[model samples]
Target: MTDQPAPTDVPTIRTLVRLAVPAVIVGVVSALVLFALDWIADIVDKGIWTALPKAIGVDPASGWWIFGVLSITGLAVGLVVWLVPGHGGPDSATTELIEPPLKLAVLPSLALVTVLALAGGVSLGPENPIIAINTALLVALVARLWPAVPSQLIVLITAAGTIGALFGTPVAAALVFTGVVAALKTGGALWDRLFLPLVAAAAGSLTMTLLQHPKFTVPMPAYTTTHPIDILSGLIIGVIATLIGLVAVYVFPLVHRLFHSIGNPVIYITLGGMVLGVLGAIGGPITLFKGLSQMSELIQNRATYSSGQLALILVVKLVALVIAASAGFRGGRIFPSVFIGAAVGVLANALVPSVPMAVAVGCAILGVTLVIARDGWIAIFLGVAVTGSIAVLPLLCLVILPTWLMVSRTPEMRITLPAPAKDPQTPSTPASPSPGA
Candidate 1:
């Protein structure tokens, strides 16, 4: 009999099964971290926006109070970045949703700043910082426990688990990781590669559900029937939202540069907070904070706002998102982008009244999310999620075609800082100074 070589690269079923054990652990731990951070943020948020205002006998919604809280929030976050270890873990505008893990020392500061931002009504979400935190913590812990396991695998599972926790569904993790796994150069069935991540994601999603149920969908009118005209309506809304997102994408770097020119975290971030306070004062409480609860409020009370009012809210929220991200806030853009998309959709319906609200909102969310995340699956997932209707699925699929083309070559809503120019007369210095400095 001729000798044959067993495939060395492909993992055995037994090997994968063993890995699943750690995947489950990673998932559960990741969810616990997410829950803890969110719990802390919620408590602080209530104190700042609800209890303290009541204690002071001031209306929480009053312009001055809103301005004061947001301005103080900026200052608090700014100090963390300037004096806290790890400088709040790099500029958020320079990072992606999934990047290389940060140092362990950085995670606490990142978490603290994220909590402060969320509590202070920053127009951002917890996605970016939380993912970074989970990835760093899990990668280090898993490496310590299982020295043979690859660090990259830990990063992937942690990310999947975190995503699952954030969305309350493993499906989101699956859709998001499809592109990630497809790019792998290994010899195995796609599902085989996905098995561990799916396990982790499922565990994370279930853990989050058991701890606190979160609903991504809103209570909106049902989208029961699909019509030929719905495609056109969806397309128009999607394209318009995409264009608006593009505007933010193009303007992001300029705003980032303007803020960083001050060259001190406390000064620039504090200035950013004051500006956000001004925006909050102008737009009222609805336009403040990470946009999830505010989005629900906006859609639920659509009847109270005119087209012009909706337009003002949309612009104000978009501007706030830009400023918050640019000015050193530790948060993600996805939540606020979703808010902006809902605003566009509601405003369209207010103007025309013929377009169904679900279609309008879903399509707009699909477009805006696609631009911000640069991932079609997340865009579609969030679009359908927001409207809570599969009826909008086909329409979104159709609308995404044109929206993708529009945004495919556009600048992402991130800042790309240039390498520092050297002065021939000056000696070079260390890139990063000590935390005590």
Candidate 2:
């Protein structure tokens, strides 16, 4: 009998398990760390938003308390970024989810500012910092413990796991990484590379589910069936929201550069905090935090608000997101964008009750998320996730084609890299002597 040669395309079961086992452990650890971050942020949130307000006899919903807390949060974050060992790591505004891992020493400052931002009602999420911290930590750990594991593999797995843990599902990791991996022209089957990442993501997602993490779903009218009007309205909402989100994207760099030009961390961040505080004061307590709970709150009490009120909430949250992002805060824009998208949907419903709530929301989310995240799958997932209706998913899928057309060739929501700095040690030429001669 002749023994056949092994194929490079298909991985053996032994090889798959060998890689999958450590990935499982990494996923568990990532889930645990994510929980820890959330727990810590919750504790801080209670202290500032609940305990302190009650103890001081100030209403938690009052403008003064909101202003004070956000201002203090800004000041504290500013001090940490200015004096801390790592300058609170890289500015999240300038970094993406898959940027190079940060140093271990930088994680502490990043975590601190992230927690403060979360607790103080800063309009951002933990996605940027937490993902960087987990990826860096896992990469270093695996490099030391498992010498054979490639650093690139570990980074990919860690990222996939973190994304899984974050969204409470492996699908989000898969969708996000799909966009990432599909662009590569590597040899062999695509799943060969995605296999380990998917394994890690599944493990992380299962762990999070076992721990009973909340899923991302909003309360709205269920989508029973798709109609022509549904498609038309969805497209209209998607187009409008995408255009509005583009305005913010266009202004992002201008605002970021404007704040950065202050050239003093404390001053600029403090100023940013003040503006955020003012927004919080105007938008009320519902506008605070990373926007997850606020999104839920908006749904629960949406009936109480007038059309103008809903419009105000949408505008305030949008501006708050821009300020928080531009102000050098250590957080992400995804969750806040979700809130803004929801608000846009709610306002759309208020303006035109003829549109189904579920479809309006799904389309609105698809538009903003498509532009901001630059991933069609994630945007569509979030749109469907918020509606929690499978019927809405198809409508979202249909609306995304045009939404993609709007956002596909558009500028992504990121800062432009600065030019390389000149060396201070270089000697200057004697221009005056030459001119005299």
Candidate 3:
């Protein structure tokens, strides 16, 4: 028989179709899951917020109940983590970096998050679970449909889409995802490949908007400042923020160890809740949850609390967050942390009348610093974006630069991914023949 000619290696339209189709399906399904999670979380949070107050004979509307809710939340979260295997969902961001994309069986993670939110009396935000479940579902579906797709690419796409949709801005999501992906060694030509996936994700997000009519919002804070003052304050605030960021980095690991080391995670978590409750009792309910509600309240009525009260709330919230996070409760620390920073900034402004602008600017700077130091720019963007303050941008940017610079100087911050292993029997190393041969 005559030898047959080999097929050309060039990619055909059919090949592209096969590849893109799976990704598109994955993207759409992921978006749907994310939307559903967010919807459900919203409904549940509102219900809990309403019912808890009535059940306990405390007005949910009053700041006093913040402690009660947070204590209960912490206790409940502790119980769930102790009882459930794998505690809650896997660490979404960490897993995305270190692990392969796996199946979407994240009920444990979701359950943990829901319970934590309910028990800890923190803010009811779906951003964390939404990202986890969405990415998990997308990666799982894509892997099943196209087994040949690279796992890292799956992680990148899912991260990009989830972040993009949640933020209501693909650009912001892209910046965060690109930074994360670069860290994960999924860069180079992969950036080129991201274009299609990003577009698909943006489309999916748009679809979500059409169905739900969700509004895209960013905080814009106004501050009065001469050029010299703004520049000088920005520099000073940035340095302070950077130092705060380093403290946060050290704080996280220490807190994580402390909470986890105590006997019986459930007990520890409940105790954490109790601690939060006590703090809340002293600081007012403003110290509870993720601080979204409090943030809104603070922005609207900055004068509601005395400077001392704001300072106390800031301290208590920080402690409560560390306790809740370390005790195996599920949720993102970003919102609560930012809220604490803002509270501190407001207090600083009140205490030092000369630097009235410093309150808003300091909050953004400190919040962004802590975020970048611990979780990177997504946290910074979130802190800045939610403030509804635009005049702080130039100052915020200036502050962020020094914070990044300071963090870069730290040995822990200069993390490098471990290189992949090469085969033992390469051209550089001669292989031995089998004894039988």
lDDT of each: 0.88, 0.83, 0.55
lDDT per residue (tens digit) for residues 281-370 in model 2: 999888888887788888768889999999999899989988999989989888888888888898898889998888878889888888
Q: Provide the TM-score for each candidate, comma-separated.
A: 0.93, 0.92, 0.76
Question: What shift in Å separates residue 425 of candidate 2 from its native position after superposition?
Answer: 22
- What lDDT tens digits, residue by residue, belong to model 1 across residues 283-323? 99999888998999999999999888999999999999999
Per-model tally of clashing residue pairs = 0, 1, 19
Residue ranges of candidate 2 with Cα displaced over 4 Å: 1-13, 419-437
Model 3 residue 4 lDDT score: 13
lDDT of 3 by residue, 1-437 (tens): 01211111222335444555555655566567666655665666666677766786867745456656666676666666666554666532232222344444556556556645744465333455555666566666665766666544555556556655655556655655555544434223544434545655675566666666553232334555436666665566556545654665557666666755787866776776776677767666566666766766765577677887777776777676665555555555556656766665666566665664443545454544354334446545654566544555556656666566666656341123455688787555212111000
Query: Which 10-residue window of candidate 2 scores lowest in summed lDDT?
Result: 428-437
Clashes of 1: 0
Candidate with the greatest TM-score versus the true structure = 1
Best by lDDT: 1
Q: 1 or 3: which has the higher lDDT?
A: 1
lDDT of 2 at 377: 93
